[model samples]
Target: MTFHKEDQVLYLMAEHDLATLDTVGLKKDFRTGYDSGVYRITHKQWGEPPHYAQAYFDENKHLLLFSAMTDRGFEQLVEAFNAFGHDFPAEPYLRVNLTMVTTANEILKKKVVLNEYHDLFQEDPDPESEKVLKEINAFIALVLPDINAGRTPGIEAAIRKSGIDPENARNVMESVMGSLEGLPGPKGKSPRKSPGKSPVSGKQKKLTKQLPAQSGEGVRLLSGDDELLFDLHLYGMAGDIRREAPWEYLFEDEVFGVQVPGKDLVYFVSVMGFEGEHQALSFYKGYEGLAGFLEFRAEVGRLSLLGLPDDGMLQASTMTGGLMTIPHLMLSFTDRDDLEKEDLAAIKKSGARFRGKGQWPRIEEIVPGHVPVYPSKDSLTELFLVVQQVLVVLEKDRYDDQYLMREEDPDHTILVRVPTGKGPRFRWRDHYLVVDPKWGETSYAVRISPASSVALARLPEASQELQLDLFMLPATVREKGSRAYFPFVLMMVEKLNGLVVSMSVLSPQPDLESLYESVPQRVLEELIKSGHRPSRIEIRSDLLFDLLEEILEKAGCRVMWVDHMLQMDEAIMSMISHLS
Candidate 1:
């Protein structure tokens, strides 16, 4: 962790290599990394690194522990595994573990291990260790750097500033040196792996690897590869950039897409090979085209990303009732290349066998100038920058109210593009999972509501007044028992004296008559509990007014359909807001 002159939080990360496990070497790397960026360590023999340099690796997994100064740096540490960790010499990509510690001291005090599957860490912060580390940090500025800088006079000056005797400064310096010599290990490099002994190197030599090989591309948090974004050594790839191109001069909009790894998926991916990654890519999905992608990119590989497995894939979270995963081409439009007839035939044969199809996807078809040629390393490097700019949306959604604007809540709202086959099931208040095709684009509306607002609408305030009104709207029915039109109801229940209430999203049922009773029933119950029953319910639809009169008769509420009134329009606007 980079300790600034003033910082309260510190992070320690460990990247363990399962191929060549080293507990002692972990300590050396931590010290090296700290000194390399922060301290002026001219010689390691005389300078004593902090005790935080000490690290304990999992007994089962080969690991190295260290610290990073920033969140991006910490993330890059994990992304490192995805990048260069793929080198034939650095095999066992799946087993390499990078665990995060909240404080640098936790490396020694806490046990960070991977769950049996080696997907997530099974450790958290230790409270006592955090307290001790804070105290240690409070005084570290006084000694470590000065000692490494070989500034005895400066150290004495600092000590004297604290009212210490000037003469004891020599003794203090001696004590610090004594501590350095007393540290457990020798002050020299320790070889962690045997040279030319990796199992993968032997296999890499046998097979001619292909560039843009079937493996899905992904940026791991911060390995050397994430830092450089250039790893072109693929199976059988022969070309290298003869001379570096002015890739910096190219406009970002010129590129088509960037290659990315298999994103979040529910289906099992048993192997980490290209074939498996490609198969997962085949199942790769995207949300609302690109709007959701903008939000999803920032959260990739985070703990939140692991929440709610998206199987059918979210059309809208409202449509699916759970967070879903989708994909975008990490590979851009300019990714294709003009292929020689023989070369194309060989690749085509392989592509067909891999996909079990005679033809490729439209984007993969061979075309001369239109095809993207990424064989050169310059293109590979340019990819990172192009993708960075292309994937983001700079504009924030404009909103006039506090409600989660459908235009802004990327998590919930989806542009209702009509699905040709089975669309996402609409989750109505968490009871019925209606898979009605009539629930398509025309009548259905989606919006986000604060949990507090939802809770307020269900409160026990009898003083609050609310009314339910329905307007007949057509929903394209696709199920066995769906209707052409469904009643769209609106409820105007106020929230906490200051809080806004949620707009209820009434589902368009295949059977509207069944809901005709439930709609008035829920509204009457709300009014009775609130003790503010209105004299008459003003609905806009004459058909609904006539049917609602019979349904609401038992509740003792009068019903009438009005032409257009300004006061009632405001109430109905809240319901209509769901469409935006």
Candidate 2:
């Protein structure tokens, strides 16, 4: 069932008499003390791993609870809190958490029940949620009765009833009671298993280097060698290595580093343990991911020093700059249908399982100059080789020292293994990584035809200088079983008054190169059709400059590359907003 932002379920602790002024402080203390920070809740009872929730005291003193596992549930909570402060309305919360309401009859029953506070509103709650809820009810039931008897409400037994260990339960109770007396309590122990070394050591010690050759400027042509392109042996080896070293043994912050021999570029590998949403070996190319990671760490440190809660610090860090923007090639584990037809066929041919909804291997090539797409067979082979190397390093514990590189480490040096030769030989290279703000612009070579120059020369020169930009729209179009691509738009606007002279939607059919190669002709044809050539054309993108430079210069139109085009940016934003 679809859960909308405007649907909510409220549960009131009817067994407790929490209407008194003293109850306000008690509720506040409970919320603050028991608060499990976002993404850090280790309790198995609090929803699922990674996506969990903490209880809060709303303005009305109701126990506010929600789970991130529900569709748009987290977003709804954020929106409600933002709009109405602490007294947020309950209309926008999910009426039935599918995780809780399992049976058809329970769903039907919940559909008729009004969304109001009640002691026993939730029926057939998931085992984990039910256990936790019972514990919460027990604590609330004890609060008032024990206080009236002039005794402190000890909640260790209640916490233990929820399956927490005795020590942790005591710690939780101490934290809660200490808050009442304005004393600092010890942090609760997390239930997650500590990071451990891989059980099996990888035997492979060297990388097979059949690197792709550079194709002119800003492009690399894949090698034609059969061994380099989809080597089944390499794929099998990588898979075996991965099977040996499960991601659960490593933390998200742990990076397995690799560097291509003779190249300055480095790729940091992050093995996601499936503890969070993603299950993949993410190869964050270049310095982008490293920079983002360091920045995020620094932000967290700064926020922690200021005494902010984990969620608040994370939210603030995310708002300023998040690591999600880093460009990385992810070797994801996903269902078969999520794979492109070609990718699925490749897997099938390799005798890999592809029929069921299992976490199959899929390569997501998200790099510079291209839209996110499934890698070709050749590219997939290359990526699998990298994955193999990373797994090997992970198994051998070669990256253990690199994992120790902290914020206080003066050098910030990354240990990268450089492949020396094919016979189990490699060299360790030390590279100090830093954030490079300058982004690598994708450039395409465009040849101007004499016929096009003749046609542009025939048009009369217009007084106005026009701004031209060829950019990918935010929206994407895709066919079933095929990879998705952003639609490109060739927009021409009058630089003076922001009047749109021409706009044409260009499809990245065949490939992006073909689309880029057609841009010069398209722009020229538009100018000729308009019967007037502008004196000068202003372009912000390096790509547009590259495509239009030779053609526009031959047409007696000066091409200027400026940092910003107000008209073009505004028009792009408007179109994007409209599409969104």
Candidate 3:
């Protein structure tokens, strides 16, 4: 019923004001270079009654009532809304909660649902429009509690419920209740006066020229799509942000990308609206004279990135520890005393030390190690090979022995934020993840997974030592789908700058020739169970590269066939089509 009367006259002067209303704080509102118009929701699994969330209005609702939540995210959003329905217990004096604003992130991503237009009020198919729609729903419950008591809606109940007489009910609510007699007559006063100024002095000079004298905030350039164009505006403290979750920051790219090495300058990066989780912000643009830096750190309430990439050019600073503490798991780890020492050196150097300690590590906030627990498919493939040996010991203990000894001399470049995940989520703070290493190079831990979890993680052929590879085999039966998905998937890149290096799964097939008849004895038994001996194998396919080169040339195994792996099979089929 048409509201926003300046937010119901300051919520009725916040009930006899002395001013107060708290709760709002759950940060991590999405950001990727540009374009924004947030407020998105839909996280329902149960807890009935309109709860899908982000309903500044509604698309789907179960019980989110967000008007900017935060009593520690409403006690974890009411215990994830009573454990998504069916744990009963809800009438505690009919709690109504409707305040908003919440953002907080250590990666809890699930966005991409924008489409809001709703205005439909049609219902006039005459036969006297159902008593003029129950006299406009009884004049909207008698003018919605008199709009904070300024009072209006009473032409004797709109002429006895629209039978319309008193001069057609004063010309039908004087053309539909003409602006409820111009609002504000209750507590927070000041109804008229603007004809010569004073009534809220033009909204206090447009909110003091949209706040920010020392209030602070930024982000400029709004409009893009050419050199990857632009569009941004968090705006001076983004107007003291009250509600706008989905935030993100790694470097928001050193302020949003500013590449000038071969000059065309084209600036990018100037947005700020991070509302705390301690603090750690990043930016560094130098290969040498792409030269720029800007880091911010704070401790205890953790935010560390203690600068270096030769912490040399341009500036801005803050300090504690150079932020790098990566841990990412997307469901299932059941328990191995929450492993750590680089997650037990990525599970005994990627051989998945369930035999040692990794069958259940990460015990953050005490026990709940990842989720979607196991029930069988051989216990989720023996806990997905002990979480694929904790992502090959988190990509071989991701750099920092002084950036791997400043990337071993010869033209160095390092920008890191690794603990990546796509398909079970974890993005560890993504600072444009670029790691350059060309002097006697070494970096390969890639995994593509699904060939029935690398055929129940084969290996044990015993000859293992090949290691420096890039593999992809699933070519079709629609990019290989069933055996409940495991028609070959493998990736491990380090031709040097190919980047990404870890993911696992390959051992479930009911066809596609038992998944290409065991890709050359399950990649020579998973490089003899990852003791990785690949001085050769480089395969990439355009329709299973001639039957994976006559099945790894009849298993003698020193394979080769990377005709630019048709751009890594269309970049892993466009990241499995934006992660399906």
Which candidate number maximizes TM-score? 2
Give lDDT tens digits, candidate 3, residues 1-580. 1112221100000001111111122222211111132222222331122222222222233122332112222233334434543232222211111110000000112221112221121223323323433554454445346643656556576456545335433433432332233222344231332344222222211111111111112321111110010000111011111111112322222222222212222122222334533222121222211222222221211222433232221111101111111111123233456544544443443222233321233212100111112122222222232332222222222321222112333122222223222212223322232332221122222233445334433422333222222222222222332222222355544443444344344432442234344444445455555543444455533223444454444444455754233234344545455745
Candidates by lDDT, descending order: 2, 1, 3
Better of 2 and 3 by lDDT: 2
Candidate 3 clash figure, as a count = 76
lDDT of 1 by residue, 1-580 (tens): 2222343223333445444533233333333222211221111221122212222334344444433333334444334323433332222222211112111123124343322222232235445444444433333346657665765546644654444333333334443453333222333221122223322222211111111222224323222212211221110011111011112222211111222222221110011112222211111122222323333333333323545334212212211111122222222111124334533453343222112231122112111111222233332333333222221111010111211113233233221111111111111110111122222112212122334234334444344322334442222224454323333444443322312232344554533334443454455444544444455555544334544565454445555654333333344443335643
Each candidate's TM vs. the true structure? Answer: 0.20, 0.40, 0.19
Off by over 4 Å in 3: 1-488, 491-524, 527-580
Candidate 1 deviates by what RMSD?
A: 26.6
Task: Give the lDDT of residue 277 in candidate 1.
Answer: 22
Off by over 4 Å in 1: 1-260, 265-386, 389-490, 493-524, 530-568, 571-580
* Candidate 1 local Cα displacement, residue 22, angstroms: 30
| Clash count in backbone of candidate 2 | 2
Q: What is the lDDT of candidate 1?
A: 0.30
101-220 per-residue lDDT for model 2 (tens digits) = 222112123232222322222335456545543544344444536644658766565455455334434433433332222211133111222347742234322222222222223322
